[model samples]
Target chain A: MIQAEHLTKRYGFTTAIQDVSFEVRKGEILGFLGPNGAGKTTTMRILAGFFPATEGRAIVAGFDVFEKPLEVKKRVGYMPEHPPLYEEMSVDAYLRFVATIKGVDRDKIDSRLGDVKARCGLAEEGSRLIKHLSKGYKQRVGLAQALIHEPEVLILDEPTIGLDPKQIIEVRELIRGLAGDHTVILSTHILPEVSMTCERVIIINNGKIVVMDTPENLTSQLSGGERIELDIVGPVENLPALLREIPQVKNVSLGEPQNARQPVLVETEGSADVRHLIARKVIESGLDLYRLSTQTMTLEEIFVKLTTEEETQEEETE
Target chain B: MRNYLAIVTKELRTLFVSPIAYVVLAVFFAITGYFFYIILGNVIEFVMQRAFQSQQFGAAPPPFDAPAAVIRGFFGILSTILLFLIPMITMGIFAEEKKRGTIELLFTSPLTHLQLILGKFTALILFLLVMLVPTIVNSILLYLLSEPAPRLVTMLVGYLGAFLLGGALLAVGVFISSLTENQIVAAVLTFGTFLILWVIDATAGTGSTITNETIRYLSILNHYEDFTKGVLDSQHVIFYLSFIFLGLFLTSVSLDSGKWRG
Candidate 1:
């Protein structure tokens, strides 16, 4: 539903996004994950036809964004980061106005309005002025405005930035539900949002795409090996040697010992289940095992590593 | 066309919803009403003076077209009043949208720049017509009171001048509004531009040189005089129409440049 090819956008000498490219299939939920100033919003804006890319092309809903922007805009619904809204207008009036400008059929406008209001959980708040609503409700109204036209593609920049925990969950669920009916591309600095809602994640940093993969794969691929953290309460001087005896164990390191309790970290190669072996080895060694748990690198760690890795690489080259 | 109407409707709704519209209407009506009364009193006073002089000299009173004089004076003051009030009407047209970040919604929508410009221009024109309603009623009242009613064609032509002049200024205001995101800045700049255009003929330096003639012709007020006289000169009509087109064209260009700057 969306194809961006080598999309580069520059404001004078500073490149906001450089040589970035990605594709989103029909009905797929694609998440753009990056730190601040990572070109996430810039890339989305290009795809939404908000502005032409400085040196690239985007085709949205099968229309070239630069050549036929109106057509692409007709089929792509964009919700900006700030949730562009008129505070003076009532929620219902605002949505209806958006529907009209989006070229919604006149007779079907009321029905479409109702549909989006219900979908965004804004049905009862229609008559209330938008400025009177809370931040979460304002965000929902923004979502409703984007959905009013039933466009084939939805581009949302930071769709869940300022919401309570429950509102965040509801918004994530709403976005998840939008998949298979509307192709969605949402950008956010929130890591778990991508994992929870997107089928595919694109991690961008410093005007470049660092990595792209499924959430599970991203965690596993960057972790190199699974780790098991063990808390043992016994003489632990020989624990690392004993745990290393296991065939699948790649490395073992011990934490500071205090009150006769020692923590051990065991790194194992491949995806093999080596926890039972480690526990058995600890028992045979006469070390009383108090806790044993497997720990995989989280998306947060992966994000920090990938983003910082690029920074260090640039420093090294410099 | 549908998109155009949609934008027009939206603009009208936004205008009426804001307090500025009512404030502008109240100010316009109050000032114009006072001026109307003063001008009527002056015209009546002049006629009574003439009757007294003619009775004293024992000669029939010379014909005095009271309604014509009143309409002429009314239109002259009306234009000056509009000179100040138009910026108030158009200052927020584009500036507020830019400030609130709704310009993104508009630029990304399926609507063309021309459609957006025309829709806003049309909405302001409609509101201008509404503002002129009481003045029209006042003219009708003046017509009814006179023994020989005012010429309907002349009254209508003068109104046409008022509408065109308002539109031309509004078009200029729209262009100025697009140049900034500050409403006050837009209004002040628009007022400044209108003032310059209003008095540009003074700079012609009393010379018959081509440059001087061109400068005199460029003054918007100079062309408006013909319409108030009920001449309906195609030259003045073309000038106002072209002036409107030029303002709108520059607005479209400004919008495009903004996209590039982004």
Candidate 2:
């Protein structure tokens, strides 16, 4: 378990992260979603005891990161954004070195080595020098090093970055499989990685936590006032008039579709979906309804809306 | 303790697998071989009465040839050269990790700063011993062909002296390596620092006798000279211990401070 209270990390005059607080429970997978330069990595570093919080405190696995770092370090396994790896070492040697440094039992090193190497997909390349391994393999080796001691808390920053789609999926699956035993906190800019691999998300922007909730709740929060898009093969000018007559419709807008196949861009008001109304109208008018898709406000839309509003507030203050 | 050994093993593994060991050994052997050949050839000719021109020899017709003294002389000078070479060896200690960003992995581990520092120093000392082996072999070769074998204790003292001096320099080098991520800068600063320590004695050479002696004692070279002569003064032991302690202390502080500065 990890809990932080008003964690602030300032670099001279600039505050990289300020007043950030969050808690991750046992066996919970939390995603730190932030844009670049949003202090995501800085917060992770503090949690991992790699950097001291400037004004606040973090307790990781029941040990204060600043005051009792050795115990916290013992309980946590951190894979930094860059995946700290030594190029000259082989995969096996590096993992073994990490295992020993983490104080893994001497007798269990062999079994730990076997278990970790297999789990991290590094078994086949145990003998390969790290420098010679591809980026994906190097990442796997990094994950192996983190898991070598069977640590209870795993903090991985952007674990799936810079990997091919297949490699990304593989890493994601690996991270997903780690949720039951290890309290995992992973940071990334990719939204769906959180949706797919994490149960809860702490969306951080401008060094502050904007929202923290389950994936379902976050999506559902933005679910009201649903938007719909339609492609009707009829008089473009008549589409807006017909849509306005619907009882649930409050407003409609017709514009050039981004794609030639889309034909018409439709904006609807109110939470009620009018896809059925437009469908009936289209057939009655003897016009072809080529495509109809219902759109809900997605996580991407919510993210943009909240973060842009934050920027606008800042601009107004300035 | 296990963590310390783990780090040491890791260092040894790197020393074996990387090109640094080969390159360092090649350059070390090449330089030491040249000096050895000159030292031996001069001694051989001097013994044969072809060229007995050096002032280091005494006029007594002593029973034992001064083979041991000659070996000591060689190691004393070799250690002086090591003041330069060991810095190069330690340049990669912390600097390379900082550069490659692998230091995060080590720093975030459960090990204490003391374990990390001691582990690194142990590896460097072991490597220094490995460097000494070939030179020791060079001495053995000299003994087989020479008329009077070297006084074993005297040669042993010189090698031990060299080891102590090497340890001190290595400590300084590790600290310097931690101050920066650039290896070249670390190597240069490390060498420059020892160079200053190497000459600290001579600055008081013209002053009062007591001042001169104290400064000489302050110089690492002077403390090493006592050991080179085969006397393990408690003073010299303290001096080397202080060197190890100071170096490790400063490195630990430097690393600890990084946690504070954003």
TM-score per prediction, in order, is 0.83, 0.79
Per-residue alpha-carbon lDDT of candidate 1 for residues A1-318, written as tens digits (9 for 90 to 100): 888899999998999999998899999999998888889988988888888889989889999999999889889899999889999889999998899889899999999999999999998999999999999999999999899999999999999877767898999999999999999999978777788999999988789887789988876655655668889987888777777778878788898876777988887777678788888999999989988997653444647765674466446645
Best by the TM-score measure: 1
Model 1 spans with C-alpha error above 4 angstroms: A221-302, A305-318, B55-64
Docking class of 2: medium
Against the native chain B, each candidate's TM-score is 0.97, 0.88
Q: Give the native contact fraction of candidate 2.
A: 0.92
B16-64 per-residue lDDT for model 2 (tens digits): 7778778888888888888888877776666656224333464543443
Q: Give, for candidate 1 chain B, the lowest lDDT window spanning 10 residues.
A: B224-233
Give candidate 2's error at residue A94 in angstroms. Answer: 2.1
lDDT against the true structure, each candidate: 0.89, 0.82
